[model samples]
Target: MSIQKPGYKSLYLYLSLSMAPLFLAFTPLQPAYAEEIKNGKQVYEIGCAGCHASGVLDAPKFGNNADWLKREQQGFETLVKHALNGFNNMPAKGGNPAYKNEEIIATVAYMLSEAGFPNYADRTGVKAVTTASTPKPAEKPATVAPKSKPATATKSYKNTNQFNRLMAPSSEWNPPQSKDGIHDPENDGTEMLQKPRVAFEPLANSTSGNRVDWVKALHNGEINPRYDRVNPDAMPVVMDLNIVREVKGSMPNVVYPHKQHTEWLDCSNCHPAIFIPQKGANQISMASILLGQKCGVCHGKVAFPVSECRKCHSQAKTAKK
Candidate 1:
């Protein structure tokens, strides 16, 4: 005796098989969603963390619900579009054009999930596409050290060619004087120093180079820095000459404007000392710059860090007709 087939069961079976293609048409297939999130995290750590992690230029802070509230209201797809294109101070794809749309979407999803809104990714209809282009996250080194045997008494050789770790985590960016690694934390005067954010609040904002547009700030009269310490009456001799340096490779040529420098500094600050007065007299390279010579003397030290390539390499290479 065969059991009577239910109408609902028959309808369900029919719909499951017949509508499979239709359902898939609307829904994007994201088989490796977990992998995509992992890749997204890596991408964020490398690039997005620079601004998002710290809320630089009013960017929504990573994992901060308050900062992301308005952004989250716009929906995931809208946020994705903003990231792919450009939003306010943030450049397209976080200023890295090489990043794929898939990676950027995944990154947005990852950020939303951390910001107390995990369902936004699902509401968007299109799941983030995973790509192999995203670099793998580095593995954590072993915390336990190896057991030492009997040690022979000898003079240890110190490595003098060690390089400084220029790339710091977002948490360290513009840290308080007491907490900042550069200052002596134990010193009594350390805590008295004003935080960079508080001091820089009145200054004009910049996307790069210490996050403060010094030249723009000076131009707008937000900051009137003294040209000389001894002579308070001395004024800056602001030259408007622009020196263009031809750079080899795909990078843009360097446009060094004397006007910006002279606005705050004197001629003796660089001429004949840091850079030779005569043209072609001093040989300069990235190696020398990294070693705190030439442009690097002021760049990586007091000005913007050397990592900001576009700050100096502003002149786009003219297309060869």
Candidate 2:
């Protein structure tokens, strides 16, 4: 070798610079990531776990390799941003307003770790912090849901208890007035209507989907049972059907026209499920209706507003001209 004084050489400098990048590459990235994941686990268990754990509404299931992998492909930052701001059918903060940006970030990290990233799952970050899930002594396989029973065909159509509660807000009618005299922000009708949604398409036909106009449409032959599957040609239309309540009843007895509703909807739509065919068989309550239970099912939703009290309270003096 040629004798030379030891000094900074280009080769040595290049190697030194290269080593810097290598060192940085090995630096632990797990600290902050681990912290976020821990926090994320807590937030997710409280707010997100309900739907996400079971994949309700198609929420990404934890440890569901496919759903998590697909979400991961979208980029981790993007996923966090979406959870913070709500995406698609998910309402903002997954419908939990209390979750702050930090809480949401942590929740997202925890979800990702459970999905696939082992570093996030290590739970080795920071000195001391409350963990979302307790560390188990041994890792256990995830519980797989049992297969559902095949539904047997029923004799008549019966609605689930949550029948109309699942409907989108009716655009046709104004939101119900709150006790405070302000427009109630919650549709209080559908959990989905934290914000107003598009109204259901107008019944059969008339000018718009207005119920009054729909009734008029039935009176005229503008629309017909020509379309109804149950009664293709009007079965004996029960006209002037009056439901008279007890004399001491707080509100006037309702005058229901079978001719009108049967005109648009199938009989199974209201039968034993919503309204039992027998009179006085079901207890009708104003509180329940206002809560969108009984008559509130249609009024103020797709048909008309209960505010028009005179419309249904059409017994004797209370009858509208």
Candidate 3:
């Protein structure tokens, strides 16, 4: 009907043309934001929030930069794989089977964001930065920052050859780095991977102070030289024996006799230093022991060769059954 012009129609046409610039301005930003994933946060809240939020089972706290900084050095990919496969007490997908891989990746990104790497995935391209430059959180660990050096740019995590994975750094910052932002783990002026493998000299002494040695000496009315020095009168010292029950292993269980050790060395030697003296407190892995920690301190160095497995594992095979 070609009658009088409708005011509302003119108004609608005028508004649409005037607002065209506004639509154009937001068009480019869509992809930038659309690519940035927040799905990880959603999944984390539903699946991982309970444990990670509060650090249950020593789970890295969500926003605790100090807690996640060292772990983040291992690379985002490694973290995702650990989540997919399951790490220690955490089940795969945080025990939620419904989560997808993308969700897990997003969850990891969310964790990194809270740890100080805001927009971690987009900035790092889901890869570790090729620098020792660590991101610092607004709030930091309660302890004082390293007085020796500050975070630098340029470090590599390519080696991935850490022998011990269970133990993470706590309350110490050694600054395992050089001025150029290089981390030579050996500290011997060589690259991480270029460093020579750990070497051990041939067994210097086959005798690892076995039970048999102690028994034979006692039967013949002789005592260990170290003990002999302590007790010249041949009087036995009163011992508060603590029998260590070894968990299942490749060899027979070991029955650690505290009485035997105390006879030669004082309580100070092992208490709170080499051994924590608490049940299950010591994560004594054979790998670390061979590297000269725990019993390896004296066992292989001076006392005896670790080759003498039967020395500590005194229980007969038949008895274990």
If scored against the real structure, what TM-score would every candidate get?
Answer: 0.45, 0.36, 0.30
Error of 1 at 141 (Å): 20
TM-score of 1: 0.45
Candidate 2 lDDT over residue span 106-214, tens digit each: 5666777888776655432221145423332112111211111111111001212324423333342433232111333344644444322123233343222343455
Model 2: number of backbone collisions: 4
Candidate 3 scores a C-alpha RMSD against the true structure in Å of 25.7
Sort by TM-score, top down from the best: 1, 2, 3
RMSD of each: 25.7, 27.6, 25.7
lDDT of 1: 0.63
Q: Where is model 3 more than 4 Å wrong at Cα?
A: 1-215, 223-242, 316-321
Deviation in angstroms for 227 in model 1? 1.3
Model 2 TM-score relative to the real fold: 0.36
Off by over 4 Å in 1: 1-172, 182-186, 207-209, 230-233, 319-321
For 4-78, candidate 3 gives per-residue lDDT tens digits of 243658645655654576566553323112222225555566678878999998899989999999889987767
Ranking by lDDT: 1, 3, 2
